[model samples]
Target chain A: MGYFLRVNILETILIYVVIPAAIFGVAALLTLVPGRAKSRPKYHSGDSWDYPAHWWSGDNPVAVGSIPDASNDVTFGGARGTW
Target chain B: MAHGEVVASTPLAADWQEPASGPLGDAALPLTAAQLELLDDVIFEAERITGLRYSVYLGDLGTDTRNMAEGLVKGLGADGPYTVLLAVSPGQKVVEVVTGAEAAQRVSDRSARLAVLSVVAACADGDISGALVNGVRMLADQAGTLPERTNW
Candidate 1:
């Protein structure tokens, strides 16, 4: 019957096309979401000096007499180089 | 129609922390006692030769390493002109050599660049302490004391 044929056509479309398309679309969307590919932090494992606190603070490793005063203007000169 | 069955299931596991003996721990301490002694000797000799206060700082500089280094140089007080501060942030792969105004007169920007290059080369070879010592020596040699009877 024509009715039976129509039902069969609709079922075929839903099972073979609609369901597969929906699944594929969901998989594509999941891949595009943020935080799925996180990056690791980079740190160097080498000999380095560890100051108790910021150098300006009182607990500097260098001698107190040798420490330079931050108030002086002469301390400001010099070129910065990056490696 | 056959019923849909759950064939397999995988549990989502939480992130785990690495043990101290792992790669992270192995890379924590970069210098040995011998290397530290070598650096101290080099610094002393460099200061004596250049008549400049040479200080070395090795650590992270947070976000703005230059500003932090400059601040450190400035904090050396009245000895500013005679001070040369070397700040190295291995994590960030940045090295800043700041010379006081007077120090810069002797150790020019070009000289500083050369020292930085030396440090970079050594660091590339996994010689952090050696790089510091070599760079300091180069800077000292470049900024050597003026002759006894020299008039500029």
Candidate 2:
């Protein structure tokens, strides 16, 4: 009985802990290895408002170049002034 | 594909896909034409690439960011399955971004801020749709890493 129990425990450790740890170890090692892709994302921007910088405002849909807000650095109303 | 076949209502039966006619196809979310346009131009565009629902609400809320924030949170909760909410109150020049609880737990404030910044930039550039889509895509990327909790 003791021999069987020991074998079961050993198999559990090997199957669960040892295999998972080995896989993680390989992944960690590979992570340290560098890759060739250094370019930023397609639309990556340090500043969020790098595109069109004007929005509509007022009853007549007048254009507003920029509206600063505490929450958002740049805020915009819709072109039709609906937003 | 088979057509003109009278079908019986059975548990084993599957429904056929119908073309969209008016506002949207049946089974699609009930939304206003304007809202649907926004979803199509902004949300749908972002979701196509990232597979996340991004909602935007433009309306007024009296002074107080906390109230606005709370209202936004409630609004997003009511909206169903939405990961993010970008609310704008033109009267107050207040912009509040309320992420769903799941998104909040997963997506960091910095990522949300970055998305907000992109929207602001887009407003500056006169491309509301572009800014919203880009921002939502970023938010979706941030939320994608989280393990989805099952509703059932």
Candidate 3:
């Protein structure tokens, strides 16, 4: 009786349930919002590539005009594969 | 941004580059900055370790992928003799690793095939960055250290 009088129902509910729930929701949202952002859609096999074709190298490969044709290719050693 | 790093505003896309034909214009690259950095580091490391130049192409290989790969490497001219080009066409789901005449002596066809297989496995799992980094490293390992070059 004394305890109940000291801590009212409203205060108990607010302290134990309302505040905690609010905190949990806010925390969850904070973590999940970043998580979702980081989970950017990655290319999966069989998935059509919607992005533009990009050529990435340490430096830009020589201009197209300078690129030798396959007929003149001396280095015939390499491997090719498909997934 | 780091410590006092400043982020700049730019009208050009992050991936903007001046290609042989012209510039990439305002086109955005598909990769994240982190992914691009990882790839760049791996290529740099691979070249340093193997004493060979490296390049990567990410795009379509057209109909004749093998020929296209050959042409790209052949086109490297002087660099072609020491270049190791790894061409990946995610759209077509194909990967080709071209080794120069000098590069071939260090990394055999069989070894290059092994690298290709690993890349195929990674591609199956949709790990393009992982495949490139690891596969490039694998090739570097296969190439071993330059015989005559002394690294002090």
Candidate 4:
């Protein structure tokens, strides 16, 4: 006769109720990733933008850094306009 | 190399390469990946068609937009005289087309102005990618139609 009798009511609640509740709470918290991804902002005119400057060339595109201020400002005449 | 192969009328896969290193290491772009890729393709195609280096600078153009734009074109260094630069300052709501001496010979001031106008109109409608593509295409088309260089 092999006896395995251990069924405390509080122990049962801790194993079946408390542990699962903690696990479920943690799992629910971890699943909030999509909400973060969905928050990538889109640009519209008049909206204050905070993106860094970028320079694109077909051959040598550069993710620009502290651009030098144009000195002696010569008008290299091309075309200028506003939206 | 422009005439080396059959060119597609629409943008195919552009050789959009990322710089190996930068100050802003892989920062998220305001535009989506697809938007950046499309701009890349348009620039590549424009360069191929006209044999003129086409570059774009997007962000603030400072208080004096023209001076900032002109400086950027000059920043192209040795390729300066052969590049056509479209510098757009969206937050400031201004756009500039700066063509170097060699490129200016092919794309006139009037034509560049017209292209800038198209860009501004598109930007006004809040279509940043469309604005750039339209400007680049118009400039390329104008320069590509020369009878002597039917390199296409």
lDDT of each: 0.66, 0.48, 0.77, 0.76
Looking at model 2, the pairs that clash are A49-B121, A52-B124, A52-B125, A52-B126, A53-B124, A53-B125, A54-B124, A54-B125
Top-scoring candidate (TM-score): 3
Give stretches of model 4 more than 4 Å off: A1-38, A60-75, B1-27, B145-152
Q: What TM-score would every model get versus the actual structure? A: 0.56, 0.40, 0.71, 0.65
Judged by DockQ, which candidate is best? 3
Q: What tens digits encode model 3's per-residue C-alpha lDDT throughout B1-152?
A: 56986666864446755576644432255677678778888887777666777878788888999998877877777667677788888889999999877677778999999999999999899988888888888888898865544471
RMSD value for candidate 2: 19.1
Per-prediction RMSD in angstroms? 18.4, 19.1, 9.5, 15.8
Candidate 1 docks at the CAPRI level of incorrect
Rank all candidate structures by their lDDT, best first, as comma-separated numbers: 3, 4, 1, 2
Tens-digit lDDT string for candidate 4 (B1-152) = 56778778987987878766764433377666677789899988777656677888889988888888878888877566667898888888889999876677678899999999899888888888898888888988876643434665
For candidate 2, write residues A1-83 as lDDT tens digits.
Answer: 88777688779899889999999999999988856342222322222322222221111111111221212321211111122
Q: In model 2, what lDDT does residue B147 have?
A: 29
Candidate 2: which stretches are off by over 4 Å? A1-83, B1-38, B45-53, B76-82, B145-152
Q: What DockQ does every candidate get? A: 0.11, 0.01, 0.36, 0.23
For every candidate, the chain B TM-score is: 0.76, 0.55, 0.78, 0.77
